[model samples]
Target: MRILYVGDAACLPEDLADYIGDMGDEWKVETVSDGNSAMFAVSNTTVDVIIVGPSLPDLAPPVLLGQIRTLRPETIRIALLQATEMGSTPSIRLIGVAHRLLPLPLASETVLEAIHSLEELRDLLDSPRLRRAIGRVEHLPSPPHLYFALTRALEEDEGNSGDIAQLVSGDPAIAAKVLQLCNSAFFSNGRAITDLRGAVTRLGLATLRDLVLASEVFSMKTGSNVDRAALQQRALLASRLAARILPRTSAELGATAALLADVGLLLPGVRDERQPLDPDGEPDERPGHTEAGAYLMGLWGLPMPIVEAVAFHRQPQRSSLRTFWVPGAVHVATALAGNEPVDEDYLKSLGVLNQLPAWREMAGLMSERIAEDAA
Candidate 1:
């Protein structure tokens, strides 16, 4: 694999090059001091990953990264910054560009782990066609009006949860969905959540921001031939189930992963409403919504755990983190709560085959609660 570091030669992850050798992995690391040289190199060579430092001199971070986005959409992008730079204007914009953000003064071990995780996750995609296909997208679709309104509010000097809630309240459908999740068993704080403000407060602003981005983007282009309502209901149900079943710290993350697992179905090359191919069938021939959704989540800079869980939820065996936390919660939720077949062999391998009856019961109860609340 080839990795490019674009920054001052002095600050490049030159030490990381030697560390990569210790791992016994055949990889090459190259550094370019300015955007001009970076662009020149990429135009003539293939690089799997690109790292950009905030200290870049010749071209602005956005300008340099924007060109990379257009030219090497397949290349994973990482933004390296000092802790203080995280809240700067350019930093805020990096949210839309970089796949991952590594704080400076970070250990070489951290960089090593990140690269390995990213490489493994991409390897699990199983479909070269899908990767090439989704790479062509400029950015994952965001609900145009809502996305802009949300971001604009976030940019304001004093923007708070109330402001975001008020903006969200303007759209009844979006407001209703956000509130439903907050009041639901997964995120409920006890009494009741009747207002969008209360919902945002309960979920906290950062989580709400991510939820908006994921849910709104996933909501676009509901397939005309498919049951859009059913699809959405399944997502909410799976999210709630995953949240309930996972540990407290990662509950919301699991919910987000489960919620976005079907995002791939809404993207091109997979929105045909076709039945899922058999679990053991050739992956290239499958609908590949899971892999498709993962690619977008990674591009959106969503955390690796969420992206991995969503990507492999359909076939948990594909993930290396075989512990039954995020991936397991999402897999169980999607299969039991959504209208899909369970991978019995995969479950059995994880020694969770016997646990399905209990999971289905829990998921069934939540499903009924959702129906009653909607009524």
Candidate 2:
């Protein structure tokens, strides 16, 4: 894997390069101080991954990344940033080009793990068949206004639950959707949810936020006649199950992690066939859905754990860090929702699943919930 790193941040880039190199002997990394040099390096050579800092002295990271995307449509791009930089304009632009955004105060092991996770993304970018399959689908959903409103709310001190709820209820479509969800068996505690305000008040801010995100991702319409509704139901069920299981594990933001884990599947580029380096499902190596989702999340300015949970859910054993159990829970939940049996043999193959005892109960409860909801 050849990585082109663009930034002036000496310590973070050097540390990240070292970590990538340690992950595999074949990993080749080169650093360019500015965006122009980084672009020159990429145009001249084949790079597997490109990592850029949000603030570059010569050129902004997002502008550089946008250029890189045009030049090398197939290359995996990531934005490297300090934690404080998240949600800023530069960060947003970086998110537009890159598939993953990594935070500083860097952990060596986590960096390596993220690099390994890129393998899955690389495989996807290399596929042509999957890209074509995805291309035929049209009208990918847009990000919900609720997400923007929530972020704005989080930014303001006056952004209380009531304010957030009022903001959300301001949109009739969103309000209807909220009422629909609340009335659905997913949340039907035997009472009807008549209003958006009541729905928000009952679900609380956190859960409502999660629901909004999940609804946006799941509502994507590819126009492929692929029964997106069923897929969305499966995804929703899996996410709900994962949320239930995450509390018992060490992960704190389990619901958020689970809900946004597979957003990559919604991207138009993932299925674009015209791109030469696009992923085709070949036997030797293929970019699976999880990898694509991780890459997309990275571009969306989501936190690292959410990205990791998306990328590594299919292969938790590959990750070095074990503090966040989202990937394992999502994996189990996805399998269960798909009506695929998850046994000890299956769990043992994925090391993280075997270590967690909550999986069985969670799976069972998920099954029951799905059945009850259907009924």
Candidate 3:
């Protein structure tokens, strides 16, 4: 693993290098005192990850960070901030550009944990063949024409939340995704968001713009091989059910995980297990949809919390998170929705077996809600 550091943190009474010294032979850390050196190193070398600090002497951190994204689209970019910058507007603006932000003085454990999680996720998704295949496809992030039309309507002075909700409600797929997201891990109160307008309000105008314009997870054109309606139906059920699971941790987050959990199913070689002999006779090594979706989400710069759930939902035991949060909720949600089987042994191990009946009851409620919505 190669890491690039773009600032000096000696004034914090801790030397970055000393704190993270020689993570053994597998780890290589490079230091650059300013933005220019950082850019030079990035141009000359293919570093796996880049870390930017607030003390850069040359370019402002945010602008340089955006440039880094343009220069190396695959490189994982992270930003460090002084505690003082926590409430600053500039720091807030950079949040979209940086993959993750860490507050300084950076703890050694925190830094190592971040590095390990990044490497582990990349390893899970490191598929050159699938990526090449996806690259061969042209212009994939195309939302329906109506989504664009809705965006235009919202842009007009006369546009309002009611109009947006009505427009969203007209499309079952987008409307369900948005509602599931609003009610799931992204945002949740005790009340279920039953209408599109309520969902729009929860998501707000800014997030709405990003979803319509920047988000690719929802924009893939439906294919003949994949049943679009059934896929979405399952997503709605799993998400709503997942939202109800582990509400103490976060309902919206769990729902978001379950909603997008099966996204890897959209990838090649991860479908119905009826493989006829391949003409080429080449072995296919693609990971399942959970890892594939998590990888794709990571590449697209989705938040780590969501990515963690998507990646580990298949086998929540694989994740190191102790509490029954994202992984636990998604694992149970997937099972309850019939996307996968529940591992009773695993739940028993975690001492959460008592929660199973409540989850089944919630699944029943979700199905009833879906039926009413269809009506």
Candidate 4:
């Protein structure tokens, strides 16, 4: 991979050159001090990755990144930011364009690890599809800070629904939505479930966490043409089915993966040029919704299983698991929830084809139950 570094040289580690040299010829590193030189280097050569620092002499990091994106849309953009500059205006703009962000006073090891992780995920997604999908991703919503807080709270031995509800209640909009959804037939069982703690208990922490994330993200596109309601319902159903399909040990991961499976559809420019699948339900060579969603989630620092599951939910066969796992569970659950058929041949290879009938039955029961609840 060829990487171009732009901005103040002091922002990088002192040993960066030595580290790159030890990695051999597979990695090419180049540095330019200003935006003009950086653009010249980019226009002249094919750079796989570009790391830009905030102290550019000629232009700001965001302006340079925007130019780099227009010039080589496929290049991976990484922004380096000081601690104080994290939430500043420039950093916010960088968040919309850059693929990754590394802290200022960059460590050589951290940089190497970041690149390695990207390479592995790229391979899993197939390089061309990964590149194409990521290139078009103009923005990734900021990580759900509330979701992180809730996750940390749950990790405590004393964590309970009440504490989680208290934390969630701080955001009036989200808290109201939680109550509204919990009172709906989908989560309710006839009695009025009015309290946040009770609703959290009913939904389980994993489900509640994802709901908050979905709510926060979908709310961002309130005026867009996207059918947010339909997408949310589909995600909820898929999550429920995934919880049923996966073993208890892996159920949470499976359910979370299913819940956010269609999130890519909400991203700007991701679906602008979507390609339809072929007659046999085979995906086109271009990365579709799955890859798009996975790329965003991955950038947000979500778990690998969740990222992998979302990436391959439409085509679970792309994953190399010999046994049913989160990806397979999510695939089956998402397919069944969306009224698409499960790939029996794929299940057969994992020796789980016999379980399909039972899953379909569960799905049917779920549908009937929801209908009855609605009535």
TM-score of each: 0.59, 0.60, 0.61, 0.63
lDDT of 2 by residue, 26-79 (tens): 887777788888888888989888888657888877788789888997777777
Measured with C-alpha atoms, the lDDT of residue 65 in candidate 2 is 79
Which lDDT value does model 2 have at 116?
A: 61
Q: Candidate 4 on 137-231: residue-level lDDT in tens?
A: 55557777888777667555447778888999999998888787777656677788788888787778877887787667767642237788887
Query: Candidates sorted by lDDT, descending order?
Result: 4, 1, 3, 2
Give the candidate number with the greatest lDDT: 4
How much lDDT does each candidate structure score?
0.70, 0.63, 0.65, 0.77
lDDT of 4: 0.77
- Write the residue-wise lDDT of candidate 1 on 185-229 in tens digits: 545646888887877777776456555654475467633244556
Model 1 scores a TM of 0.59
Clashes of each: 0, 13, 4, 0
Mark the regions of model 3 whose C-alpha exceeds 4 Å error after superposition. 6-22, 30-37, 40-46, 53-63, 80-96, 100-107, 132-227, 241-257, 267-269, 272-287, 294-308, 317-329, 339-364, 368-375
Scored against the true structure, residue 281 in model 2 reaches a CA lDDT of: 48
How do the residues 137-225 of candidate 3 rate in per-residue lDDT, one tens digit apiece? 45333334654465456435446888777766676776666666565533455579888777668766544543333223445653425
- Candidate 2 overall lDDT versus native: 0.63
Q: Give the CA lDDT, 0 to 100, for residue 270 in model 1.
A: 60
Model 4 clash number: 0
